[model samples]
Target: MVASVPHDRVRRPEATACAAAAILAGFSLACGPAAAQQATSQVQLDEIVVEGAGGKGVAPAYAGGQVATGARLGVLGDTDTGKAPFSVTSYTEQFVRDRQARTASEALALDPSVRATQGTNAPFDSLYIRGFPFNEGTSGEFAFDGVYGVAPSFRVFSDYAERIEVLKGPSAAMTGVAPNGGIGGVVNVVPKRAGGDLTRYTVNYGSNARFGGQLDLARRFGANREWGVRFVTSLNDGRTAVDHQKEQAGVGALALDYQGERFRAWAYGVVQTDRFNAPSRPFFMAAGVPVPKAPDGRRNVTQPWEYSDVDDRGGLLRMEYDLTDRVTVFGSAGGSHTGVERYFASAPTVTSAFGTTSTAPQFYGLGVDRQTYEGGIRAKFETGFIRHAVTLQLSRYVEETSREFAAARGSYVSNLYNPVGVPAIAPLRIGSRPRLSDSTLTGLSAADVLSALDDRILLTVGLRRQTIKAHNYLSNVGTFASAYDKSATTPFAGLVVKPWEHVSFYGNYVEGLSRGDIAPATATNAGEILAPYVAKQIEAGVKLDVNGFGGSLAAFQITRPVGELSPARRFSESGEQRVRGLEFTTFGQVTPQLRLLGGATLLDGELTRAAAAANIGHTPIGVPRVQLNLGAEWDLPWIKGLTLNAAVIHTGKQFVDAANTQSLPDWTRLDLGLRYATDIAGRKTTFRANVVNATDAKYWAGAASFGTFTLGAPRTYLVSMSMDL
Candidate 1:
């Protein structure tokens, strides 16, 4: 059973303007019939030289070009952070359009160990890296390109990303099992391809009015152009800044490539949709209460006739072939489909401290489907003094989930600093969705790395062996109540050690694989299905890079396993959390017109086992202990192209239950931006203005690892122009 799709017939406005004009007419027929067949070929082309060189494509941008000098370490491809010993960052597509970042958690907000456990007008996109929980609830932890059930399963926009990588800790032997057990970090994405020729356009505005449009195109053909194409699309809609909200979105992406010389290929596709009317939910305190103060950020406890809808479709296919020149063979396959519908109202729970709240509006539905497959072999020989680089992988992933809900006959009472207006309640519709859960993962990995002397020593090792199957059924009838098949192996080791050509010194020890939790329904062994947990990490680092700036300093520790409910209430995995962290990072041009990007992490989490033993040493619920960012940009030796930027984000106090006595406080924010650039009528333009929370701090900004808490964003205001068509 899985029939449900009616949000007023998918919000007809002529079906979103005929689905954005049939996706801009299929992006002009994918580069207008390959440039009208190379302009009536007699074949005499030869001026396509497009080079911004960086091996295996998409990596070049370091040194003030806005991050990226290597990243994409899943199966270890495209790496090079001083020979990788982990802790990577990557970001570019010109830093997601100079930070106009519309998603992927706002392009990871300059990573201070990431955090965004929902909100930025939530409709899905949850995070919190280093201190755990990356995309929670029905998880689909990022990754796309480096594969993982193909992206877009709950929001990931940033128009056809060309970069966005982050790796930080446990990788399950370098990316394999993570269908829902994100061991602290890993983000990936990297799509856009087609270089040289292009067309661009943008137009945006935000804050209280919203409105947007964007399109980008790229092209290339044969006769050595080696075929390529790219397309991106976007559309936005009105009113926002909270209070009875409104938002709409759409996107279409396409990327294709082939730079063959020995076979190489890539293909991608995406389609997205989102709608909200009262979308935003995160707050659930009510037990011993206490944890309120955080109201006016354009407060709106929903009910503008509540609504929400989402749809996503995804695709990917990759290929490689060298077969010699030191062996290469590669493969990829992907799939994704997500669907959701909502009528809202289910996370309000404030209950006092002068805020008082409660909710009940439900009409939810959800569906997810995913698929992934990979194959690999990478070689690069030399055995004498060690040169290696070997790799060997095999992966498979699958998922399916479905749900439906209907509740809302009563229940209400609100006030988060004045939010009243309740009268529409006939919702509760969503018929049939059942199925709920099924997964299958498989793996087999191997790694090598090696390298010695002249390369200044490096080493890495790996192992995977995963395997996990799951099932859950019984939503009303579907049978099969709970099952799990497990296996695990995970392991890895690393070391770098340049020691001077600009410094480098790293270390690692990893392992991760999770999937084991299922008992809920207040557990008496409710649905059982456990067994398959393992997480462990250990890291150390230092990486510099001098002159044009770059930095890193890591320290890590992870340890996982947690599932609770005992005292004979039954449900197990015992419990344990441990996080321990210390990151620090910096990036590119610190002078030369000034440029720099954020960093700072320092976590400490802990709860070394607890089913309640007074919650062991506590400090786990939403673990915060400092996260920070810095960001900067400047470059206006008197306006030639002008520029200026800012950022300051911070977070600290957390804990919101699990006996830590309810908490959440420390906050800080600030952001600002500006841009200029010349030529207008003759094209080549650019204009921009930004101001996110530019001092409109209302606090409570994060926390969600189940303790719920998000709500912070209200100083909005954005503007954009962009040209070059």
Candidate 2:
């Protein structure tokens, strides 16, 4: 048994403040001498020679400029890739290293438009992107290392990532399909690779008896520095604060690279396994009534009899060769296989009964197997008159899934007696049903960046043409088959102007398209085909890069028609939506020893049309009206090797149903962290302590269609230690 930290004991405000102040003082002392020396040297520097033409040569070459470049989050791309017509936010390894984010969902919580819903069982994570319900199978799409792959919904881990990028607005021009294209966004996760000398280890312990550790190692070899390798491994296990809940997980990954002056080869493999208990659903009070809690002050809806488990493994290979100084060729192939087995109890509520609730054993199993292969070749050529870049790509993807649902005989009790009275049910056996789908996409695109007007103004124009083929197979619906093939020519144009040294203004227009899949509605129309779905969006924004501060503001709008709803075999032409919003982000040093990073968003999302059967049109459920994040990091002069950090987050109220009859109230939360670092036994070691939800705020994160509400985690504390060699 493990001892638990009492919430009241950890909530002492004076102690928390003292710890934070000590850490900040330590960090200040650690850097005081160095900072003084640098300040003195700055007074003796010589005048730098002017280079290039125009006002660019008049700009000061300050060390602070270097920090501006290094402060970038690499998730946006390989480097400062520049902003697109749409809003894009990049979180770099520096940010991750400082926050100590444990999962992809945790990392994305900083973004206002990205919301995560934790699963009670398994490794499942659901997201609401741009006010639209998105899942792994739907509009919320995820990519790894800039490539598409199937990630297990129930069990997910983000230990081996370098950075995560969130691209707002429609992206059909890049990714071939958008099951949730109407929502307008995509998340790209960049994987860590074997680059630079690296050796790091970390261990963490949290309340509720949780403990875990991770190791990362990388090395380079060969005379020309042509070969490199990186390996990572991690393990975690323990019970959560929730009742009847425990979790255990393990992960491993290896990456290899070979690079020369003209060519590069890379390969990677990852495997992960997790077993965890799920949370119970919660009951909610009716409108105008007071909120309710469980008898034990807990809010679990599922009985203690059910649990969830998952296992995932996948790999990828990529190769690139420079045929010429202005041209390059690349190819990549990867695949993943996932299997899930679950035993749970599902019962209909008294309000609207879909089926009888039972304690009898029920089994639901799903196996998903997918493979993707893509190849592309591109060239960059410039003439004094115009600059152009062209790329042509062809890809094929295939996914097959097998699902089984069955009921067991007799009342089944695993650990405790049934409270609601178990039912003696007849034996029922359902054979496995299979679903297969395949997509072949071919695309050709060209973009030109022109500096036509004395190089003062820049314009980028591009176009893409794509053809998609889709096929579907289901075991229960006899032999129902249909094919959809269409080609779309999308064009994009943008303008960037620099009227002053510290400011840049830009505007852009881009088009997006999403292909729709067809399924048999009835035996008579089994051969009928539906038209492909398409979405379009436009956005504009401005960025300011002054000496001491930087910020960006953007607004966008997206529209798309609904496609066929899967499994239900129903057409949803009325599923039209429009989302428009503005985002503001700022990060920099307010003073020499104080730094701040924060942002806010105000947005509106409305469903212009609902399925004719429902006849409901209103603000989409789950899309909040306002979101905010603010944080500060400060260093003190008295202590050495320490730092203090604090942050506050708030989310506005949001509707919970299609008709906007029910709603979740606004919520606010606070977090604090203290860290100290020093060299011990010839190794660099660091310690960190953090409190999440410091106020023990109680709020509902979301609600399911079944009228069940999900509660957010209460106040919790964590401590961790890390070393570098």
Candidate 3:
């Protein structure tokens, strides 16, 4: 067996501090040394002026740019949200940078329809969208540049992102088949690109001594400035607001691209490493134990010896060629390799309502490698007086995963309100390797859109054939436990009508796909493979745009089968879960000095059918009934370069179990921010500060889809300063 680190001997914290300091010092040298060298140059330098503007994939900064007017649509290319038949929101890079966001969860917290189940400091990133959970250690919910299996499998950060786009509903026709089958929608990230020649540096600090720095450099060369290159790197180290929290992370990315007359192509390479010590995990109360009040959000019960570490590497390439003025062909291929090791007391079995608990944490590790690719062709033509556009695409993905597991010596006793650590616990040695799972997904899709009446009306119809295969093994010492292969077809239709120039009415019927549930070992048909599942959705909405100040109101209903453990102890798909909700959203400027961004969702979710008759009409686990958010950014006329921002997010009470017997109270969170733009010496500079959970409210944030609960984050502060050379 492996020996364990003592409870009092945590990982070296000074090593992380030194690395972070070195990163910041390097950035300082890059900013000052180059200019000093230029001033002292003995030889004249010939700076060749490249002619023509280079291709820039990132959306340009617009007037009062808090949100993007449109987003890149898979196969169909970039689409204007006003003319699209779906509810879509794309947050710009400016919003992310000015808000001083570090992770995807913090950046998306303002969306009314979303709630971070694990709060912001947990090891895993989990969320609920439209009253459903898209969570797991490996969520597979994130898409990079409209492609899956490329982003980090465990979690995603915003260090190298240019923008984030969320398509609000089922999108089998728009994105083909997702690996996780996220019926609610897809969160896609656009990587930064090289454009104008420039170099930027930033220094950041947050609560609990968090400190870091970043370097961003871009350049273009070649005839017509057809070639471009960009590089970005960052490192940060600190303890979080939580007690004894230790965290450190480093990330680097390189982007290269070429924009020719008829051909455009780009590629990206990224690597990241993250580690945590004494990190907090969620609790799972026993069925008979009375639920206890949530403990202080800033307290930590984790053992100092327990930790989680992750290392990830990924690369991607995309190309597009114009076959003709009205037709184009495009293709993209990407892959990622991720390794994770976690040993923590994540399962908290409550022993009493007075805060006593029993814990038995284990060591779990996994490595996964994936390959994904897609290609498509799109063309536009005319049929009589109607204009038509057609697209055909194909995609495939494969992943191989292996894992190892070991248990600690004995259980440790602790309290939820006050904690104690037990010594003499030993760690296990890595004895063997096990082949865990291998999965594959392949799909083909075709779509057509027709427009008429001076482009006032549009109708789109699409279909996709999807196939999925999964293999599960009982470790390397045993035979395969199950092999599942399934196929299905999903179809969708949409209509958009513009009775006036600034008003549009739209409706759609779409479907999502997923691997079906199989019978458990207790069943007679144990190990049986089932067919794929298809979720259906119907939605309608109205959109308004008046000089860039606009919003949308939509109503939608979605239904899908859920897995269940029958009274007989057998597992099957016996419940039909449905969610019906109305969404209200607004964005853009109310005036030149004032901007607004926020929305609200009202949902009614229930189990329409179930083997347990008593649960048939019960509310589904973790589905919040209501959510609201409203934020404003105001440019101070009295202060030429200053802006003030604030937002509020509220989530209604939610059940934690299918029986609806256990529930968490509603929570309200507040955030405030400020920014000032000015010239420092001769370089452009910006100073920003933000505070989340300003009140330090102690509350359970919410529950994940699987009935696990996460405490809301504590009061946190973030500040940063950036300069350009």
Candidate 4:
């Protein structure tokens, strides 16, 4: 049973001993970032039929298949993307159905270090990667198959993903401590499994009158076929391009599997609901206005019966076994619950910029419940020439939240480039609902990865000890104003060198831990709570893969600690916020009919200390020293299956305050796409179309590192069709 007869017997990796995983990360355990049950409890079914055989665990696709040569580095189970030293990028599901992207930040906009800070009809899916800010409803920061209460604290809909990696820097010791820490990195999402024979259907459309449909099913039989099943569903309804915004969504996902020889299992389920009508607002300045002039991205000052609604459900189950062939044991658990209702119309305070504005009217009801768990143990050893793979993990996440909001006293003055709307005021309620917050995140990690010379020199080290508890209650005197518990220990290191097998060179050093920062109403000791901060990073990179393309270039630095205002103005936490950078990217096939993906970034952010010292060396507000992305795809060589694409996005200036005298300019956008495939009568078809912001530029889509401001995302149009049913 357990690894039936040594599970195809094989062993040749040995270098062992990582000091019992750095002394068991100092004890208190639970936390496994992207731990696929710690590599399926150490795999082994002849190492999954030797490398890849139906029990598929991600990775495959590189070279024009829309990215993915390697990903899932939390515990390094899918290594090789030039032997990795960090800086991942996955994205594939045929690149989100040929870039018809409906979420996951528009398929990560082909990452020039990611951006998507809640613009584009805004059903909310915030992001900013690499230069900070990550707000999926305030820091839950996505992740799903790789854990994190099954992603959906605010947005998660890319047809339930099938890959979306994006790792970058500061991985609390390689995926273990991120219960809202997000030291500027992390985004995993890999759901949708169940292989072979499948039936599908899809229909979609967009542009001011949305429409959608989707359903997919997959199957497999037993007796060696190993049993599997998959199901998916989706629906959307629409109206958007701002002005009167409207949206509706629904999703259902299910997956089941079993592959045995030494046992393998899987389970996943999800249900989602969504709604929005008129919601899309963020652009407040005031304090000394002057950052105006960004009005017409189909202007909509949100006031036609504002709305938002959401509901969610979840499930997960996982298993593994292989207590031989060099050990293996795995486990996983999951939970999820969410509900939110919002009535809005905030952000619109200008003060003066000739476009005068003002608005204040909000209401909200929120509820959240989350639970997660993970477990692991892995081993594979060798010594003489070095070779090892060891891991020990534990994880936990808990959450409970409840909220009620109010803010409808009176105020509505318009003119942010001529905008007016009134008649809606009813919010002065604030509190009386009870349970406001709660959180718990635990972790324990230990790792090792080595391979000497012949394997091309690779090394890795790990440690994690996270723990962060939080509380805040007082929704109406239920008491508990605050409570916090903290702990930290994050550490990691990595190195890789391949001299040339296609080129590779890497480096890493990481640390990250967060929780501690609550002082925002422009601070003045605003809500207090500070003392759980740690962030550090250092990176170096180079990668390339010749023939079929694929490239990378990196340089990094990160630092953290903040809480602003306090040259006596109190608010403390001693501030700090470095973040140097230099990144470059590239992707598959530069020939075979062209294909490419973007990259470019170069920042040097700052803010060393605050509270007036003239904002320390400035440059913090909303970070943007340059960002770019470029995409291309072509394959019209007499149209065998057709394909055409284009993408280009840019961001450069940003700063909306922090005393940086206001800024916010510099933007660009352009996107276009097409897809085609055929088979018709025998069924096996595909067709797609897209056009995003194609010259509908009215600028201003940057600055949301917390101080509002968004626009730029107007001209959009999409279409889709699929079949195999």
Best by TM-score: 3
Q: Give candidates' CA RMSD values in order.
A: 24.1, 10.1, 9.5, 24.5
lDDT of 3 by residue, 478-498 (tens): 358899888889988889999
Ranking 1 against 4 by lDDT, winner: 1
Which residue runs does candidate 3 get wrong by more than 4 Å? 1-55, 59-63, 476-478
lDDT per residue as tens, model 4, 681-715: 86668889988978888888877766787878888
Highest lDDT among the candidates is held by which one? 1
Model 2 — TM-score against the truth?
0.79
lDDT (CA) per prediction: 0.81, 0.58, 0.79, 0.77
Q: What is the TM-score of each candidate against the true structure?
A: 0.34, 0.79, 0.91, 0.32
Q: For candidate 3, list the clashing residue pairs, or say none.
A: none
Q: Write the per-residue lDDT of candidate 1 for residues 272-325, one digit (tens) a residue.
A: 899988888888988887987898789988887888998888898888899888
Q: Show the lowest summed lDDT stretch of 10 residues, model 2.
A: 52-61
Candidate 1 vs 3: which has more TM-score: 3
lDDT for predicted candidate 4 compared with the true structure: 0.77
How would you order the candidates by TM-score, starting with the best? 3, 2, 1, 4
